[model samples]
Target: MGVTAVLGECARIFTHPRMIFKLAQRELNVDISTDAYIDENRNIEQTIRADERFYLELLVIQAADEEPSTHKIEMYFITYCRKLSHNREASTGPDWRDDRQWIPGINMDNGYFQMHEYQAPAWAQHLNHIPSHIVKLTTLNTPIHRWSLPGVPDRFQVFIKRDDLSGAELSGSKVRILQFLFAEALRQNARHVVTGGCLQSNHCRSVALTCRQFGLTPHIVVARVSKKEELEAKGNALLYRLAGSHLYLSPTCSYESFSQRLRSLAGYISDKYREPCYCIPLGGSSPPGMFAFITLFQELIEQGLFDNFDDIVVSIATGCTAAGIAVGNYLTGSKLRIHAVSIALSKEELTKRIDLMLSDIGLSLGTNDIMDIIDGYIGQGYETITNVSANTGILLDPYYTGKGTQGLLEELKKNPTTFQGKKILFIHTGGKFGLFNGEMDQVMNLPGNHANYINEWPEKDIPLVQ
Candidate 1:
């Protein structure tokens, strides 16, 4: 007879002796010694204390079939484990200076148990957002292609998985973030959603679009752009206006002040209209927001994307996405390397931020191996683009998939042997719409040879005589 069962919260100890003994007796029908002495000195509690939510691991253990087999015949079980906890306050966040001392949390430990089966919603069963005809060009489906740079070896095959192409107005990483935000808003019965970002924020645009989709009004607080700027009408800003989103411009206000202002405005609107308003932090870098990427990881697994790659690279902005991806990777036991490229924060600051995020998700590092923190690409600060990045953007955007590609180029150049024959996938998070606000001109000045294209082409009808 075959035994198959789903375990909830007990899969964390897939390799534990006690777990093995129990499985052998229950599933294999083997008479294992119940009085067998087991070592209790294992710091299982400490390990579990590092990451509470990560305590859940899905395990599939099977006993092979044989004639009169000592082991069971084709017995398999999938279980989840909850790590034990010391119940201590988690460390403030990750330590940027010390990679060796970093510890992830273990708060969700209650021991592994079976999960109850649940049916999918009728509406959810028939819903399909991604078109069936468009082949998903991800790391799992296609071989990564390398972009050649001077002095970089062709052996470095760095391919970008275009998460940016998810949609036109709803393009980029923020789309996934907005999916969760809208779901939560609907759950809370919110009539209006409020958020703030820079003058050219893709996140802000996504929030506006999501609000429109869910029949909720969006109120956006934006910082004023400099008057000297030549704005483009084809990017995210244009889309936001077209979506009929309400915009509020803030001049000479600090981030804290701007947040306070939004709160005050929300209160006034709520009082006036008697409708509930939902406020999201800048860039949607909150705990619930991080679940967007976690859910993405789940989708990737169901699609079998994790089976092909040994490492995954993502462009890090606020660090929430990176943390979520890391936690998801850990939970799934995909064992893929997560290389995060710092775009805004420093190596130290990013580490701390990710650590805090993981803590919020009930997971911890706690002297265990966590994701690799790679900094070195953050040219100046958030939104600051370097000459190389500009060139990359020109080559890769409209597509907004170049900064991470550039970083991958540098990484491959620095250590060609690291990727020797391994496949690498770069997550192309969307920000092309943000780039459309004439910001690229300020960051990436056009070459003198190309100046004629922009300046002389409109005026001159004929080519200049050589």
Candidate 2:
């Protein structure tokens, strides 16, 4: 009853109607319906299937949408209602029980269906008919692996989404944002990139690498942290340097002023060098950059990720990725929740940033964000380190992932009864390099964690290649 339960729900929705009725019968409380919008010519038949263990295996939504395609909001909404028929426990009240509550309102703009809770899907792909054409950053549909922790009450299931393996250099959730940011740069035919982030910012590393690949120069501006040494120390900063990005630093902590200064500097560079310069905001939190997660959430659906988990937890630093995930679920009719744990900012600051991004994308759907924010984690801002990564056997960075994860874990431990039988996904947005700080090793290694390398190191000398 781990993520397999989610897989079951997903599988039932995509399976043939014959299989669905059979599955519903087996489950006793399940319902399957295709009468939401009748286009007899439309095909409810899917080309995907379930696997062993009643798991909801993955499916790649075909990029083509003719009429209420699974890729579109209309069909996804209907399909989600169908799946909700099975998992009726997550929500409460008559509103949750009524299928009509899930029925989308007609899009006044496009005549397409939109959720009552969110704007239409087109707003996600394009803001006011302007395209957010994102470049393909990486082809990593990271797998969700299941891990059970000891000493946790109820033995509730936990699944971790490995975005840490999203790429070799352009790793972490930030790359998803860069996919759109860099695509915009390419669209503008820019020859140089300017961006800002914290000293060890993963977005900076991702942007620098993208610039290297796309033949654009990258200049990074950051305010000084007492931990400025940690930037040269390792992790994302090391990768940023390795990508050969020009570095600009402000000794003061006036980040907004620093961003404006960087903007001015980019203009100067553009004028002096006679090449177009694109300036990216901190953490790539613009509309296009934020829309990358919309693409990512869709990718999760196509990859069958939605079928495997109930909740997704992430570190919400600047709120870009979290905004995407939250909005994507609404746009795509995926009934999933993103639990965003604050890494550095206050919840109000996080909410404000997300709202600002939504405004940028021509949306004013709800005053309340579509996601939940947990801010008990940022005890000393980005300085306090928690060893949750060690206890959970995951590689969480001391500043960001570890501290945030610890907050979530402590809350879960305190309120175990609330999440009983629920499967949670902890997204491991990659910052593996942060494990090594400065020239000195920051984290103590667990015994035998690296033993596999030596034991399986080609048997010392198998044979030289011919």
> lDDT tens digits, residues 1-466, model 2?
2222332333333322333334444544434353432333322332222331142211212111122232243344354445643443311212111233223453223311111112224535456423435455575578877755433446557777788787787767777777666656655756688987777777787888777765567888866753445347467777888877878776765546877887897898789777688999887777765566776677677667667777777888878788878888766666676678887888888787788777777778652647878887775322223233434556667656766566667657885543423777777777766656552232234343331223455755787668
Give lDDT per model, in order.
0.53, 0.60
Candidate 1, 56: how far from true, in Å? 44
- The C-alpha TM-scores of every prediction are 0.58, 0.63
Lowest summed lDDT over 10 consecutive residues: which window, candidate 2? 56-65
Query: Model 2: which residue pairs collide?
Result: 7-56, 58-304, 59-302, 233-438
True lDDT of residue 50, candidate 2: 31
Candidate 1 wrongly placed segments (more than 4 Å): 1-152, 224-234, 251-264, 366-369, 380-400, 415-421, 442-466
lDDT of 1: 0.53
Q: After superposition, how far is residue 418 of candidate 2 from its true place, in Å?
A: 6.3
